[model samples]
Each structure stands twice: as C-alpha cells, then as structure tokens.
Target: MSNVKLKNSTTELRDLDALHHLHPFTDHKSLRSGGARVIVKGDGPYVWDSEGHRILDGMAGLWTTNVGYGRSELADAARDQMLELPFYNTFFRTTHPPVVALSQKLAGITPAHINQVFYGSSGSESNDTAIRLIRHYWTLKGEPKRRIIISRKNAYHGSTIAAGSMGGMGHVHKHSYPVYEGFRHIMDPCWFDEGQDGESLEAFGLRAARALEDEILAVGPENVAAFAGEPVQGAGGVKIAPPSYWKEIQRIVDTYGILLLADEVITGFGRLGTWFASDYYGIKPNIITFAKAVTSGYLPLSGILVDDRIVAALMDHDDDFNHGYTFSGHPVACAVALKNIEIMERENLVARVADYGAPALAKLLARFEDHPLVGEVRSVGMMGAIELVADKRTRRRFDNPGRVGLICRDHFFREGFIMRAVFDTMVCAPPLIWGDGEFAEAERVIGRALDLTLADVAGEIAA
Candidate 1:
C-alpha cells in the first residue's frame, strides 16, 4: 500500500467495497484506489485475507478479540441461544433468563461494591447510558448544577454524539455538529510526551493528576458531576498514565464528591492482566463502562457497572430510574456474555495475562528499547505501544504521520501481520490466549517491518 495501485483480479469484494463501503476514519478515495483486502475469516490468532494470505491479528480485531478468533464455544453458545430465543426486546417490564443469570455472574466476579449493572448493545451506547445516568442521578439528588463530565485530552471513548463528546480525541469532535454541552476536556497524565526533564515519573504523575482538581475547581466543584477516563488510554496511542495518577484522580473525585467513570471498553476483561483495568489501577470507579470482551464480541453486548452509593441513591429516591434501552437486557447477548466470563474464569485467563503476558511481551519491547527509530516501548499487561519518532531526543514526530505510519503498516500487512498505526505509534492488545511463541513471532514480524520502514521512509522521517 506504499503507492497503492494494486489490482483486484476477482472484483467481488472490491466491487462491494466500492459500491457500499463508507469506512470510518479512512480516506475513501485512497481505499478505493487500493482494492479492499476483505478479511473473510479468522482462526485463533490469524485471519485470512480475501486473497487467502494469513495475517496474524496483532491488534486483535481492533483490540476486541480477547478469547481469540474461531472460538467455536462462543459460536456454539450464540447458536444455541439464538435458536431458543433469537431476539426479544427488553421492554415493558419483560425479564429474561440469560440477562438475570449474566448480571448475577458479572456482579459475583466484579468487586462486591460495584454491583449494579445497566446493559446496552455497544460500548458507545453503554457510555451514552452512563453519561445520561450520571447526570440524571445527580439531578435526582437535587444537585442539578453538577452536570459537567471531565475527560482527558486525546482520549477515545466512542463515536456516538454523547460518547464522542465525552472522549477527547480532537479529530473525533465535530465542530459543525458541536459537542454536546457539559463535557470538559483536560490534560492527560501522558508522562512520556508531556513530562519535563529531571522530573520523577511519580512527581510528574501527581502534577498531572492535579489537573483534574484544577478542572473541578475551575468549573466549580458543585458544577462537576463526574470524571470519565480510560484506565490505560487505548486509542490515544496507548498512552499509559503514570503510576500515581489514578490514585490522585480518585482522591480528587472523592474530595469533590464527584463520580469517577472508568471507560474500560478496551482494557476490561483479560486485556489488562486483571479482570478490569479499574481493579488493576486500584481506582474504584463510581461507574465503569465495558464492552469489546463482554462476550468476546460474539454478540453485541456492553454495560455499565454502577457503584453501591449511586444505586442506593437511585433506589431510595427515584420512582423507576427513568431510563433504559429497548434491548437493555437482551437474554441471548447476556447468556453469551456469561459464558464468555465463565470461559475466562474457568481457564484463569486473567491470571495468565498478569503472569505471562507482560513477560512475554517484554522480550519484544526489549528489542525496541535501544532501536534508533523507536522513541518508546510502553506496556501494561498485553496492552502496549511502540512509538516512532524522527528525533528521539526532542520527541519530534515524523513530518508526515500518515505516510510514514502507512509505510510501516503496508510492509507489515504484506508480510503477514495486522496491526493498527495510531499516528506513528504501533499499538498491540493481543488476545490473552497468546503464548510465548506468538509473542516472539509478532516481535520478529514487527522488527522486520521497522527495519524496512526505517530504510523506506528515510526521506519522510527526516523531513
């Protein structure tokens, strides 16, 4: 794809893509010029392109394939449930078995205090529910002015109007559409990029975390309701916040009596070494939005786990809580989610991620620690990022981020790997099921790509 002019011999996929494909975050014309490489199927850690080339899913299907691809068990559970009950809208006080059972299982596994759950069909929808619920909850308590929800700059939440606004990804915001009112963007604890020289990581973390306090105070604490953030910033180039950041953030939110909403859409399940990134970071959020691995993405399922305090407030005051989706608690989706959790638990997959994921991934990272073109190798559990820079000393990005990253991405794709180029940062949140060998293979492939990228993008990187 360096100068994508490839031809599609069989026009089946390309024709469909050209006719009906309105891709998100893509240059449609460029994609049209480059015939679409339709990923027809996947098995375990690999997927086959339309041309039958096997590519290792380094990004794990946009960081969602926690249990890995071709897990027949998930398929089987979905199939069985679909046959029994395909679709039943969770409306008009109708209840279902899977929804009830799954909620119970989730509550049992998650921290005891964070027990109440609200269901939605997607991460975006779940976050939407969270924002509304958070605001409405505050309103119910007569604190109507506590409406502002704080989010970090460069954060990626979701694409819905509310969720996108809650997220701080600049490109995600639509000026014409204008973000909905009451969502404030704040600086992140991105140590590598923003930390000043001679500052200790811990010191930098505390300073960064205090920004939330500044925001709350600036906005007036009485007007701030919640602070929404990802445990490990996923799409904003896998920006790992400093160690003390979450603790400080929790302290600030607690001081202001504000809610902490953890958007663990990517870092939840087994991706973050623990069952949830909030648990891993020791930040007990008031509300946590989850998706992706809820059912290993087998069926569209997402949720928000609410803290006991919020639940108690709503229960004692509100008549019925006043909000829910038609598919709030779909039985089959919930059933599959329960099964996915069971599979993860029965195999100790979360423990495995903590024990083996980082160590195995460390080897790959070690190779880049001293590489000339590499700026940083940051990792937490299976979640990691390899940032490329022109001047490592100055932290200068390549002149043409799109071109340079695309070169690396193209080479890797052609050489049998699938990893996303987040600007010039290559991100990886592979499935927890990956073993030592898979890690090594990914490293080798990536190393080869880097070598070629450095050689190929010499002019672009230099410019």
Candidate 2:
C-alpha cells in the first residue's frame, strides 16, 4: 500500500462511527460490537481501507461505479459545474443547461420511444415517481381504479415506503408495516431455485411470465395500472431470467393493455452492454427508471425515461404533476453524469462489455462451477452469481438462507475482495474497466474464499 496519512487512527475513526453512525441495511447491535471497516481511498477497481489494505471491488461500489473510481474527468466535471452553477432546482417552471443536456443525451441512448425524463436523486425516489406517474396517467384517462402495480417476488425496487412496497422482498416488507397499498407480487423467474423438477427452462420461463397474467386476472385487469421489474433481478442475487421470459411478459402486458415499467436502476447505462436493459431485452416499457451508472457513482442522480405517450398525457393535462425532489436536476450531478457518459462513449465501454467483458467474466465465473460448494454459476454482461449449496447435484441450499453466503462474503473481504451475498448466492458486478489482470486476481481471490468457506461448512455437505 502507498504511504497514506490520516489525522485520526483507525480505532479512533471506528469509535466515532460506532458512536454516531447508524448504517443502512445493518444490524446495529452487531455493528456496534464488531465496528465497521473504514474505507479511506479508491482508485480504479481497488479501494484502500483505513488500515491501508488494498481490496479489489467486485461489486463496483454497489453496482454503480461502472467507469471505476478516481476518474479525474468526473471530478473536473463536478468541480467545473460547482464553480459555475453550484446548485439549482428544475421545479417552478425553471430549467438549467446541465439537466437539459443530460436529458437530451439520455433520450438519444434510451429506447426510441422514451423521449422525456423525470429527475430524482436516487432509484427509490424515481420509483416513487414512476408509481405516481402510472396511477396519475390512468387517472387522467378516467380509470382511477387502475392503481395496483404488480411486481415479482424477491425483486428489489428501492427503500422508500412506496418503492419498498413495490419491491417483493419479504424481509424489506417486514420492516415496512402495512406496506403501501396498490402493489402486488408474483413469483420471480428464477429458474435455479424456483423451477420445478422435470420442467424445461423454456417451460419454466413461460410459466414465470404467465404468473404476471395470473396475477393481473386475480387482481382484476381493470384495477391494474402497470407491472414493474428489473431486466435481470440485480439485488435479488443477479437472477437472470430464461430467454423466453421477457418476450412472454411483453405479450401478456400488451394483451392486457397495462403499462410496463422497467426499473433499470441497476441495468441502465451499459451495465448490461446496452444503454438500457429494455433495449437489450426488446421489452418496450412505458417508463424506464434509471440511476447509478448514469453518473458512474461519481454523484447522486437518478430519474425515469418517460415514453412519449406519457409525455403527451402530461402535456394534455396542463396542470401540476404534484411530485419532485429538492435535488431534482441537480446541476453538479447532471454535469458529472454528462462527463461520465462522454467517457463511456469515448471508450466504447458498452460494446466492450457486450463483446469482451461479459464473456471474460463468464469464463472466470465458470471456473468455480466444479467447486464443491458451487451448485450453479451464471453471468450476463458485467454481473455474475455463484450459488453456494450443501448438495451440488440436488442444488440443496444450506439450512439457513444467507448464513453460508455471509460466511463466504466475509472470507472474500478478508482476502481483499468484495462480493455481495444474497441468501446463499455470491454475486459480483465488477467495474467496466476491469480486464485480464483484474480477472486473474479475481479468480485467485474468489477461489481462495470459496475454499475457506467450503472448509467452514464441510460437515454440512452431503457425501
């Protein structure tokens, strides 16, 4: 590690954090006892902790830092914008150059039908906006009863009350008491865990798609406004659907005439080797929620791509939409996003992921397929997952979900790598900048972690 200096020692920092910082998605009691790892610096795909241990970032800073870290260009963009505009709101009939330029660029890259944008600071806020827009659009069309939005079980939309309600994760819902009404969930098309024995993948995919139709019928099609889903369930352990899934979903939604909302917060901006996953999957959504990679995690910015039809409805309404954020069209965030897109385009990161990064990562992940703890390994574009199981042949998960995955995750962190654990699945979404050297290092670290985790649970494995 390079010579680094800090005013306070690591222990002091941890003490201060433990005293004041309450982290998200954390067990506070456990964190207070064990303390938190202090991340001090980041460059490219590596981050250095307070103790100066350089760790490979396998999850791309929560799957947002697509262009990697420490990009002087993004810094320059933010600095330049701060020096000029600093901050401004897009509300009250006001407009700004940064947001306008970013919106135009986004329109050029998103699905052809999506020409308008609604700005927010995070995916959660934007998803909330999507729900309002969906219901409001139907209300404007004189169908006030069309309010229910169907999402898939285990899919994660966001953390806000409304967004969290849209998400189908039971754990999240347990916290959101009386989850905001108007959202229903169906089974996710996760073939590995949910597929029945003797069911072909194609058949399972169709069945999963049919789940949406069934839900719509059960809820009464007249009361359903839209269906929301991630292209490949990112937070749900990188759950990639079978080839037949999306096409069948599109047909079902079309037959019902309900809107489709593609939550591309994780899959947008070249993560899936396309500007938007909707384009890659060939699913025409009325709205596409995006964030994360747009600014490449350099700044907080997220929004939704509104189909022209929705825009037309708003235009015809001639009144307030009654929703927005203080950080909507934040000039600094928009400026950084503009520069981020420029860098991505100049480097052809999207094409690189499609042609090389995806294939390379797939090959790297496939190396773990024969490992004793691995039941399945899957990847698409820059993301991948390894299912850690007790019985590989039977695909039997460990007794307690997330227990073994946490064990393996800690091993990876201690081994100077970062991989997220979702239940018993270890998932990774590396920086788009990774190449041969990063892959080689990832292979070594991942293999070592798996071996350590296997030894920890060796007795649990079926002979």
Candidate 3:
C-alpha cells in the first residue's frame, strides 16, 4: 500500500490523456492545461485517484454505482455471459436468453401496465428512443400533427442532441446549435426558488405544473404529443417535487390525451427507495427511460420500459417497429444488469434505503441547514443537494455559475470527496450501500468544504 506509483507504468495518465483522450463535455484545450483526475480503482463506495488519494464517490460515479463498486459478482456474470454468447442483434427478429430474462424481470418489477423493454446503452440513447417512439405513437393514432414534447426549465435528460435539447441547461445548449424542434419548455416545479412570499409549496407546485397546461393549450392540444419529466429533477440541482405536482401533471396529461414520459435515468434502479421513481411519485407514465444503475455502472446499459398499451398499438400496426440499436440488449450488458438487480434484491437495498436513509443522512444535512450560503438542503432517499446562493432571503444566484460552483467543487475535491456543482447547487448522491460511518464522514467532509469556500467568496465580495 506504500505508493502504488502515481499512475500506471509506460504512460502517466496526464501524458497519455493529453495525447489521446478527448474528454466528454470538456474543453480539450483547458483540459490539456489542467490535466485530469484519473481514477485507478474502486471498492465498496470508495475509489482511489491516480494520486492514491482515497476519494468518496459522492456523486456515485454520475449517480450510478447503486450496488457500490468492485462487486466480484458483476464481473463474474459478465465473464460468464461473454464466454457463452458474445454477440447478438435483436434487429433481425433474433433474440437472446439474457435479454429475454431481463425484459421479463423488468416487466415483473415494474408497476402494472408497463410490460415491455427497449434496450440501449445509456440514458441519453434510451430517452432518444422515447422521443422517437412517443412522437410516432401519435402518428399511428392518426394524429400526425401532435409532435410537441414539453419539458421543464433546468430539467436535465441527457446530452444527445434530442435529449439535451429536451433539457433546459444553458451550459449544455448555449454554444450548441438551437435546441431540437418541438421540444417545448416550461418552468420547473422548484418551490424554493420560484415560490412567492405568500404562496404555499402546494400552490407553487400546482402553479408550476399548470405552466404545462398553459403551454399545451397555447400550442393546441392536437399539436402536443407528450410531456417528459424526471420523477424528481436530478442533475438540475436535485429539485424535489411537491406531492401535488406529479398528481396535477398526471391529471393534465390525461385531460389532453398526451403521453407522460418519465426520465428515470437517475431515479431508477432503487435510487429512490423504489424500483422506479414513478412508483414513489404515484403517477404512471406511458413510457420511462432508465440507465446508470441498471448494471451498477459496470457496463453501459439502458432501456425504455413501455406501457403494454403502447406495445399493443405497435403490435396492431406493422410487425416491425423500425427502431433499435446494434447493441440493443447486448448479451454481456444484460448479464451484468441482471446480476446488479439480483444483488439489489438479495440484499434488499431498496427497502434499506427507504427505512434507514433519512435518519442516517439527515443529521449531517441539518448541521448545514443554517449555513449562510446555503439556500436550501433537500433530499429524498439517497440523492440530495446543498444549494449556495448569494442571498438566501431572495434565492438570488451568483452572477457567475461555473466560477462559484467550480470553486466550491474544487474544495470538495481537495477534501477527498468527489462531488460536483450542478449549476449553483453542490450535489451528493453516494452509493446506496455505504455504511453509516461512511455516510456520516461524507457529510462531514462536504460540510467542511462548503464552509471554507463560502467564507472565501464572502470575503472577496466584501473586499
């Protein structure tokens, strides 16, 4: 354990990455100047960077890693499947056993009326499928004009052209070409920032939900096919939805005969103390997109779990749906995901999160609830955020997003907690399997970083 040599031999990550890797969502020029945080190994919720620093994965490796890291069972499952049947395509009316078994398990666990699974490799692509399938569902129903898909401001779906446009992240879409056509946006049901002086949280939730109704009516109900949302907005600052919000959204979509597409990429696979976020929210979506935790981030795997009725419509039409990926239900990915789900069940991780999570994490957050820079501390299940605002009284954001957030995140990174600032909020979604001690340590570390960073910023402002 004495210094595992700063990086692997032959090529230091800095030197190799400089010449070879073009990192995603990063400016290559800036990356070349600053270098990378190369992760070397992981075991049970803790990872070591190339520097040999033990880093707690506060963001759960992009909000996946549900069963935690270094599970030998997942590796064994992948190895077994790779040897048995390495490759197959579901495109040519051909299917494989692992794929079949996974679909059955997914359907069985999913709430009633959702009976089919369409596979992809990530949430972005799966949501891209939802975009295609939902719009086409209208065409099959003889309402071809209904192509608009409504989303919310600050909502994050994914980075694909269609999915990123579906999101309202200014950072993602600003320099890029215009957002995808027909992906309409409305305000988020974020009560803390958007609620007025006298408005109740319930009233604000309804008001925000009503924006969808207003937009749909303005565009004409015939022109709108579906409304897409995360059950609880993740990545967009972990915004919690009020109880009235989802029910009202369901009511609105039902009233207009529009489809409800729940993007469960982060909230799926027991992240929310349930199999699907939709179940926790108490609303049924016609289509749902999932990824990240499916294989516990072991292998890239994602899928759209469709309502049986949507599948029924496609069955009645042409025999072929004319959509799929080359790696659609790829055997190895399926094997790994099946193993991940099995681990979740055998250990009862879902129920554990529901029962023990709040008390386990709340004490830590309560300590920072009164921190001056903290505008809010909100969490449900294992996912949470502590938002930093220039003025908590007004919920006013700092003039610069990346500057303040990046400064705060750098502090956390130095403290050996790998957390990120999404917009102005510091996000923390640790592996659900983390023990109480690790959980407490994570909050303590993050809290320390916040105090140091907030004071530095305040001093600068005063100067």
Give the TM-score of each candidate. Answer: 0.95, 0.98, 0.96
**Candidate 1 lDDT (Cα, whole model)?**
0.85
Query: In candidate 3, what are the lDDT values of residues 1-463, reduced to their tens digit?
Result: 2453543542465777788878888878988888888788999989997767999888889999999889999999999999999889888679999999999999988989899999999998998999999988888888999999999888888898889988878787885587778888899888877888999888988999999999999999999999999988888888898888999999999999999999999999888899998999899999999999999999999999999778877988965677888999999999999999999999999988888874576666767887878888888888888888888777777887767888899999999898878867887787889788787788789778888888878953321
**Once superposed on the true structure, which residue ranges of model 2 sit more than 4 Å away at CA?**
1-5
**lDDT agreement with native, every candidate:** 0.85, 0.94, 0.87
lDDT of 2: 0.94
Could you give candidate 1's per-residue lDDT for residues 232-289 as a string of tens digits?
Answer: 9899988998888889998998888899999989988978788888888888898888
- Order the candidate numbers by lDDT, best to worst: 2, 3, 1
Clashing pairs in 1: none
Query: How big is the positional error of residue 461 in model 3, measured in Å on the Cα after superposition?
Result: 6.3
The number of the candidate with the highest TM-score is 2
Leading candidate by lDDT: 2
Query: What are the per-model C-alpha RMSD values against the true structure?
Result: 3.6, 1.9, 2.5
